[model samples]
Target: MKVFLTSLFLACFLLIIAPPLMAVVDLYEFDTESQRQRYHALIEVLRCPKCQNQNLAGSDSPVAEDLRRELHQMLLEGKTDREIKTFMVDRYGEFVLYKPRFQKSTVVLWGLPLVLLVLGLGIVAYIVRGRQSTNTRKMSLDELSSSEQDQLKSLLKTSSEETETPP
Candidate 1:
């Protein structure tokens, strides 16, 4: 029983550390090399609307399969890459591409992360520098006027007198 448990644990460990699985099947049903290349390239660039993080070529989701089929049909119709992408963007919003287009709507998508990163780093640096200055503030003797010094001493004397006099 102990040996079986040890073997099962070893198997689980090996499975945990296994390399990423690539179930790459021939997706483009084409006799010519150029058609296949174009088909592959289009699929690779076209993002899966359902699984927005993965391209149609890399994702095995049902929507990815449908998107791939649609891309194949577009290729057969001799649509250029741009036309296909534009059709997709029109059908589903600009989120269909892995790289957002540099148009007005997506400008925030591209710039937001960078802006947040810069702002976050600026705040962190400010805080770290703030923490490093333990004794940065100091009063110079010349900065305090004699009248002000006398006022401070009088205030202190008044506080002590009040304490001793008990109200």
Candidate 2:
């Protein structure tokens, strides 16, 4: 019983401490402060293909680590940000970028929201104008011309008389 308890306590302790020990932190030395800033910025804006939703800087997946290493190496090589982005796009396709460039292929992705919004506003405006016209055309008894008032009285009298008669 004592041995079982000891083993259980030891397993609990190891479970508690193992996760922190397993997390890997990258420490790359840059030649200049600008290179370091650029490296950090690029990682922040780039998505991890394996993780889908997490950016490179936030993901701990092996693919994210490899991409971070590749980005650091590219910075050391003095590649422009555009060139690095181009290389990544070429190798991984455009899904690796957090903000894809505007191109013919992406026109619908960018323009659809604006088109939908304008269409929605147009429909709303049409509905509102139609309602406004209907409201304005409705004549109150006080607003009706004398001849019109006489006609309305006759119609109401006939309607009431018809309702009072059988069938």
Candidate 3:
């Protein structure tokens, strides 16, 4: 019974700790601190083609691993950041870039948010103006003409008389 309890405790501890230990960690050596920093930054901003929205730094897919290796190789070859990005774009297309450049091809991607925001603001303003006009019309006692006021008074009197009588 003592041995079984000890084994159970050990198994529970391993289960709790194993996930962190099993996490994918890339260990690439860089010639300089700048290179290491640049590599880390590039990986963070580059998306994994296989994982859709996941960045290379966070993705554990085989494609991400392969991309990491390719990036490391490029860095070792002393490729400029722009050159590295261009190469990746050429090979994997713009989808691999987390933030694509503003070009004719990507104008919609960059401009869509601003256009939608302006459209939304215009719609809200129109709705607010409509509501304000309606509220003003409803709330203003002086807006009622003499004839309308007289008709309103007669209606109120009739309603009051009807309400005062038992059904």
Candidate 4:
């Protein structure tokens, strides 16, 4: 029991400490602190092409590593942020950027949610209007033909009489 407890404790300790050590460390050298900060910020925002949902900094895919290296090289070459973004966009399309630029191509991506919301509201309004119209158009007993009203009254009288008299 003591040996088992020791092994469990050791396993727990390793599990707690291992994740921080397993994180990717970008080792590229930057000439200034600002450059390093810029690189870090860019990697955190840039989406990994291969991982789809993960940012370049958090992804372990080969494509993420390549993009990181390219970004580092661009920074070292003194390329402006816009120039680097344009380069990545030219190569990988707007999907590479986490915050995609507002352009003709991306209007659908930005506008789709609003459009869907409007459509949903329209459908709800239509259903509500249909229900209201149906309720308003309901036929009253007074509006029924004299023969139909007499037949309904006779049916109700027979049903009530049958219920009042036990079999």
Candidate 5:
């Protein structure tokens, strides 16, 4: 009875401590190298619809697996890359492709940020230069009017007299 309990405890401990093992999918099942390559390529370029951060090949989610099988079947049926992609787009929309199509709608999506960055840099440069030029135009106390300069000279004279030692 002690041995049975010890064995059960060991089994539970191992189960809790073990790292998750990933199962290998058989790519060899495809008859031709081209079919295998096409399958891999299609899966690599496709974003996992369920996990937006992962490619279909890297994600083990059911949606990714299903898409992989569909891609394999499409390759077996001799579908062109364009056809397979079109089919995926029709079923899943443009979000499935990692690189979006270069359509009018997506042009701003690709180009707007870069344009904004350039415009922002130009504005910053203009503001910085304006400030620098204003600082470079330094004004001296000697360049003031007679009345304003007299007041400054009187202030300096009073401050100097207060700091002087008696002779």
Candidate 6:
């Protein structure tokens, strides 16, 4: 019983700790610190094609692993950042890039927010102006003609009398 308990405890501990120990580690050595930093930043920004929502650095998908290796190899080959980005873009389309380039195809992505904001403001302004005009046009007692005022007074008197004496 003692040996069984010890083994169970060891197994539980391994289950809890082994995952973190086996986490993905970058094994590539960059030519310079700047290259290493750039590699880190690039992985964070580049989305995994297979795991659409996850960045390359955080995704454990096979595609993410392959992309990471390709990026590392490109950096080692003395490829500029722009060249590497273009290569990925050509291969995977704009979806792989977190910050997509501004082009005819992607203009809507960059411009839609501003367009929606202006449209919303315009609608609000129009509604406020309409309300203001309606408020201003409301007929106050002084604005009514003398005959209209007399009619209104008679109507109010009848309404009050009808309310006071229930049907």
Best by lDDT: 2
Displacement of residue 165 (Cα, Å) in model 5 is: 11
Off by over 4 Å in 3: 8-24, 135-148
The candidate that achieves the highest TM-score relative to the unseen native structure:
6
> Could you tell me the lDDT of residue 55 within candidate 2?
93
Query: Candidate 6: RMSD over Cα atoms?
Result: 2.4
Model 1 lDDT per residue over 1-167, tens place: 99999999999988876644545454467756887899888888888888858888788888888878888888888888899899999998888987878988878888999999999999999998887774465565567899988887899899999899855
Scored against the true structure, residue 163 in model 2 reaches a CA lDDT of 96
TM-score of each: 0.51, 0.79, 0.78, 0.64, 0.69, 0.83
Residue 122 displacement (Å), model 3 = 1.4
- Which residue pairs come into collision in candidate 5? none
TM-score of 4: 0.64
Q: In terms of TM-score, which candidate is stronger, 1 or 3? A: 3
lDDT of 4 by residue, 11-75 (tens): 99999999989987769988999999999999988899889599998898999999999999999
Q: For each candidate, how many residue pairs have backbone atoms clashing (under 3 Å)? A: 0, 0, 0, 0, 0, 0
lDDT of each: 0.83, 0.95, 0.94, 0.94, 0.87, 0.93
- The full ranking of all candidates by TM-score, starting with the best, is 6, 2, 3, 5, 4, 1
Question: What are the clashing pairs of model 2?
Answer: none
Evaluate residue 19 in candidate 6 and report its C-alpha lDDT on the 0 to 100 scale.
97
Candidate 5 lDDT trough over 10 residues, lowest sum: 19-28
In candidate 2, position 15 carries an lDDT of 100
lDDT of 2 by residue, 44-130 (tens): 999999996899999999999999999999999999999999999998999999888999999998999999999999999999999
Q: What is the C-alpha RMSD of each candidate to the true structure, in Å?
A: 8.3, 4.1, 3.0, 4.4, 4.4, 2.4
* Prediction 1 global C-alpha lDDT: 0.83
In the range 97-145, model 5's lDDT, one tens digit per residue, is: 9998989989999999899999999999999999999998888887899
- Residue-level lDDT for 51 in candidate 2: 95
